[model samples]
Target: MSFAFTSRRLTTLALATAALGLASAAQADNKNLPVASDGTMPSLVVTSTVPGGAFAGHNKRGVALDAEAEFPASRLTAAEQAVFAATFKPKMAPYASAAEALDPESVINSDRRFRVYPQESGYPYRAVGLLTFNQGSGSFSCTAWLISNNTVATAGHCVHSGGSTGVWSTNVVFYPARNGGLSPYGSCTATRLHSVTGWTSSANPEYDYGAARLNCTVGNTTGWLGRAWTTASQVGVPIGIFGYPGDKLSGTQWGGAGAVAVSEARKTRYPIDTAGGQSGAPVVQADGTGPGTCQGDCGIAIHAYAASGGNNSGTRITQAVNNNLQTWINQP
Candidate 1:
């Protein structure tokens, strides 16, 4: 199958019109739901609030956390909190925090293929970094990569608490090029979030894909990655996985190289080293000749799960995701 990608143009008027269309549809669909402060389509609401004071926590990144770091009680209803509490909580990583551990060679010592991505790493991955938000127990982190001037792609679970719960994530923020607790390109909150209904409803791993629209166009300053689908041959090509693994130094950028071992219907397997915080890291194929190679490197999958055998897997990006991404990109 041919790889599909999102197209960007400089049509201000067209974008404005599309935004209006999305806003109208959102109102008709859920008028009771809150709309974005700018009168645009509101992000998916987490209706239930976490009881008691907001569960206070640290970002692992050394920077001081902000009010956005906590999920306010008014947004999420009590019912939603129960759904979030029921979600699986994987065991916490044992490795001590690798803060300020910029040298990847030292941290991923067990594996020769993995290395730390330096602070000055060039685009398009320079826009990839840790994504943080509030859930049931407390705050959590994942990986997210910029795809457009203001759009970030991450795993579905990071955006929505998929299952019958419909517990959408709240107070989400992105830290681009974060290295050892430092946000080199700064951070921003997600103005709008999008994810597949299959994942939101059934928690399907195959459909574990999501995107967030940032409050500002940070990608233009840091650059963003392109995305595409590929056949077995292209899929097998060596690809780079970038993210902040909880085990490696909380919120520090890490990089590793691995080739796709197999391509399933909607997922790809790789032996990339990753931990809990690495979820949503982009599995990106580097610049080369092929359908998805024209725009330097293109992201093909979203890092989602890992196994004890050292095998890590992600949700394959499909045409449906491409269409959703287009809808998000065109929104005002």
Candidate 2:
């Protein structure tokens, strides 16, 4: 299902920087945590009731610690440039396994320095926000965005703690177009969750992508992004990511735009600035012409991990994953 994108109301300059913590706002609502469904991981589970039942675990926020923020173009030697060019060539076959793939010539986008996102922007920023959930005695936070009216995409580890013994996260909430403590479109609890079995069972980073079905139809109000399975030839194409990062002003929303550094079947690497809470932020490319093109923006991948402090990577929305998202979105 598709909807028109809406502009977020901007707050006064002084109030814009004051960060709002969703966990604290809804902490008292913990008793209302939603009951865990019986369905298995990697499969979509849908619930009708509103989200609630907060647990006792502390809130875990994601953090990005990169000493070298963006890569320097002038510093790239001729040999390094050749390596990057070769590594990003279009592939003839699908990726064998994102879990075992190695990228030796990874680079970072230098367009944006790690910082806060402007309050008012276009569709890309409007579709992104903060996601918080109850884990044990505290709540953990990550970034997430709308791909459809009821579906929000994010990192699998954010939905289910990765590893062999991973368990689903409960009492999840999404705050779209959040600025400071303000939630422009309000917040909704996840009625259902979806992730790949590879991530839930083995904590495979390649399968880190995940999605949530919200009880609220926020898409009708704020609009949503479209999904696309990008190719290696599309590598270096400009993309933008808007999300909530813990290192920034008290978890306020922030964003950065850059090109795809590495494109593979399982994951896509870019220089977009992100941290812990930023996981799950949609890595989107401009879809079509004019304004509101390609249903606001085409979601290329789900931002999940970072390495060497230079490149922030995500689970590329391959054909298989794209099919899964469509299946989940079409579910009743």
Candidate 3:
């Protein structure tokens, strides 16, 4: 897919100055922790569950990670599609494509997100999926990605109503690489959902992230993405966001890439085009060089909100978030 980027480049002198400023700040704040190792697991709260116990299969041992996208031999048969359609109703309420509270000018004028054809056959792409859950009387949809053999990371709001009076979502299901009525990898029900207290208590956007432990070890087949946390400024880091968008064809995965425009202590902003269902999409390192601070297919943030001032944003991976993810990924 093609991304629209301005031809402007930062000069060597400017780059040097920025680096020096960052170095000084890091030294002053002692923020130079090792990206992959510094995080300590934080306490997590259960936000939802599947009552009769959803666990069944044992996780595959020594499963190898796929370095590249894989294509399926064939699409689902008509009978299979019919069965899935009858059982899994597509009654998802559209997440707001653009946050109404934000300035309209903050949103990108052009929607550059491109559909991922045969998304179910792609590696990292397939790991990203459509998340549908029951929240009150309605079914709502969001995006999520596999971070472990049996767990997926997503926006906290996708799993919980948020705040002290918030209610946990129920009947959460994940359809990896779902394409319209085509569920190439089938789907898995989340047995247990997780979130942090900051969001569960105050609906804080900074803590607007969560995970769901699946009833199956599908990540062993699709392969999960790695995550990293860094104190360094992520501005200009090339990243891609891929997930199902409510505005596009239902259940279709769309994606786009762009450099981080603004990097704050807990959030990163970019101009990559996205819509409502795209929340919880992985903000992955797009250069293929891996994250400078972590190994493998590393993701740096969880895409959470729409354009605020001039760009869309995600909850940046920080030490606490990283630690919690590491712990969740290891949970049986």
| Candidate 2 local lDDT, 30-122, one digit each (tens) | 221122233733322211112111111111244211111121112234566345333322111012234323432122444354444423554
**Highest lDDT model number:** 3
Task: Report the lDDT tens digits of candidate 1 across residue range 1-332.
Answer: 45444323322345456546445534543311221213355322111111111111123466432223222112224565344323322222222123312121122225533546544556655668778886555567778988777788887778776666756677887877766545555678987777755676566656667888888666666666766664434446677888877665455677788787767766777767666677788888766644444345667788876542335677776544544555556567
- TM-score of every candidate relative to the true structure: 0.68, 0.65, 0.71
TM-score for candidate 3: 0.71
lDDT of 3: 0.64
Rank the models by lDDT, top first.
3, 1, 2
Report the lDDT tens digits of candidate 3 across residue range 159-268. Answer: 77777777778888788768877666667888777777666766677777888878876766666776656677788888888887766767778888889998888888
Clash number for every model?
7, 21, 0
lDDT of 2 at 19: 16
Query: Which ten-residue region of model 3 has the weakest summed lDDT?
Result: 1-10
Q: What does the lDDT read for residue 139 in candidate 1?
A: 66
